[model samples]
Target: MEPDSYHRIYVERTLALIKPDAIHRSEEIEDVILKAGFAVLQNRKLQLSPEQCSDFYADQYGKYFFPNLTAFMSSGPIIALTLARSNAIAHWKSLMGPVNSTKARETHPECLRAKYGTTDLKNALHGSESFDAAEREIKFMFPNSVIEPLPSREETEEYLSKHVNPTLVRGLTELCKHKPLNPCVWLAHWLMKNCPNMPQIVVEEAEDKK
Candidate 1:
């Protein structure tokens, strides 16, 4: 099921980038993310090529910081996470603090960047600044992400209530318990144990009738 049906209730998803500088502290940062009530919908550790990094940050092109920013982004492996929450776009950015992390440390000591970042170029995290940017960034990171250009209201509501809400509750409950070191690993085990029978949907092709 697609996940973009939240114009009314504000369930949103955003991309949170754990930049190269913070890759070493990935687990600590992830613990912070989970404790902050954000769900990790998808996670991957990938090394971006220069071209990919440039295209991803195209909006900053021609700016003074663009070249250095892109170079840093492509320098090493980084963690890309699809984080979801009630207001994920803003919430994730708030967790990341400002682009310049030395200032973030002085002002917002609890922020991710402040804890892990050394400089603006070495900033530990990246977050989508707006709703449109969130959507576009998610697509850039996950090109084959399910297309939900327009999800029917009723179906979307049904899916969320039936699947998303309950799983979130259960996930949160597990997170609160004495658990595995890795949240994603715990989730994988939970899914394998619980999902005995996955429903298979069959789309019937139309046929001519006499």
Candidate 2:
């Protein structure tokens, strides 16, 4: 699809990570995501090195908790997923509940973290807080999968020809009309099926509106 055509569709993207603690609890985590309506753009299991962990959390480098956070992140393998949907960041964060496990346990006991997280740093999952963050995180975590340099008109046309079938495109357009707050899984599936080459920014813009 053309960039302008994609803008007409209302798309959005976010990044989500199922931390080491959730390795044995993949089924449950996946259930929460499926129910929430996000599409998985790409997913991988990665065991981060201490250096990688530090770089990934660079913003928190000098925090009092930095050392512990880095160690915990490197403790085991983690699953990273590029999620697409309407209101992806907000929806993913809501599903994750709160940053503080104690609060998550008390106020949102049904959340993913409340069910699986051991501490604030060992939280079973992580999500991008905004579109910009999502883009950066996705690039950092999946550099090979990252599609840089916007697709050209010919590339877009070829992508549309190969992937964006009428039935799939119509279904996503209908989904956009539903106006749900989260709707990530639904959007993810749609993108997987029809708009695989759609830019992350285009997807985010599509879902930006309430």
Candidate 3:
């Protein structure tokens, strides 16, 4: 691939959480984010319940600081931002600096945690560690947003040929035959009823073994 195309193909998205302690400095934080070449695709302020915080940080559930972490996270509203750029996860992590504020101050004095954070536990920000974590975290914070990566050109063409085109072609053929007054409406209804790619219905046949 050409250099530009390769760079374009590697565009990534990561989730960044402005923790409660830094919510008041959100404007400054956002200015930093923008300056660092991140596109803020979506953002929201959320006041999470302890249960929600626990669920969001499920990987840390059994850790010693779990309870305190959950309680602190639930204490106030934090801003969740969907940031996109090339190498976004690593870049955001670098910008957030060390999780321990004192360590961040020593090693990365210009980092957000060093500038805004007070302690190790309240590091004033959170960033996903990897692509999978980014996907899960983004979905957890922005449930309704579609975070799936776009399929490759080959994949898109194959899917259109195998699934979408056949249904649309058949629908159009039927529409032409009947000459319906509202052709779009007729084709839409026909596709819904006749499309072979209808969503599957899964039935749970047994209770949980556990």
Candidate 4:
């Protein structure tokens, strides 16, 4: 089915990574993204440093799986992409199927990960969970191009007024004031509230601003 015209007008973007394990299956992954209506804005392959891997997975630092995850990520080269489309995050993740290759194959045989991945950690792909994460992850991976000016105060206020609830607006405003990180979660929540029936991909993209 075709995407809604309104959604097309408000197209969003997200970051997607094809891990080393999927290098041989890159074409298959690209096909999946294209079929999902996402346009590849930028793409590249790089061998990551251990420091970069650790920084990228910092959120999982305290978790038991962090060490292994870091090792796996730094083990080989990876493909990074900037994908543009409506509802990018959720859609991309859906196309990726599950984190565990075994489960993905059984439950979503046609999914990218299911077809190319060898295991859970080597699951051939990585997608930012939210727009904020996408922005951070993308910047961490592609420092040069990812750096851009933050939204101005007036712009932020206007955006909040038009798209967010008063209660949420206040919280998000505070978040911007202190954290000043990407506002992926706040943006996703806003889109969900305003466009409740939008596709998952659209929601994901909305969250992945960078």
Pick the TM-score winner: 3
Error of 2 at 171 (Å): 17
Every candidate's lDDT: 0.83, 0.80, 0.89, 0.77
Off by over 4 Å in 3: 1-5, 150-210
Q: Please provide, for model 3 over 150-186, each residue's C-alpha lDDT reduced to its tens digit, 9 standing for 90 to 100.
A: 4544565566667777777788888999999999898
Ranking by lDDT: 3, 1, 2, 4
The segments of candidate 4 whose C-alpha lies over 4 angstroms from its true place after superposition are 1-5, 146-210
RMSD of 3: 13.0
Backbone clashes per model, in order? 0, 12, 0, 12
Residue 96, candidate 2: Cα error in Å is 0.4
lDDT of 4 by residue, 94-205 (tens): 8888999989999999988888898988899999898788778777777778455345435655654565446455666666776635677765565455462454564443
- Stretches of candidate 1 exceeding 4 Å from the true structure: 1-9, 147-210
Weakest 10 consecutive residues, lDDT, candidate 2? Answer: 196-205
Q: For all the candidates, what are their Cα RMSDs to the real structure?
A: 11.4, 14.7, 13.0, 17.1
Checking candidate 3 for backbone clashes, the offending pairs are none
Better of 1 and 4 by lDDT: 1
The window of 10 residues in a row where model 3 has the poorest summed lDDT is 1-10
> Any residue pairs clashing in model 1, and if so which?
none
**Number of the top-ranking candidate, with lDDT as the measure:** 3
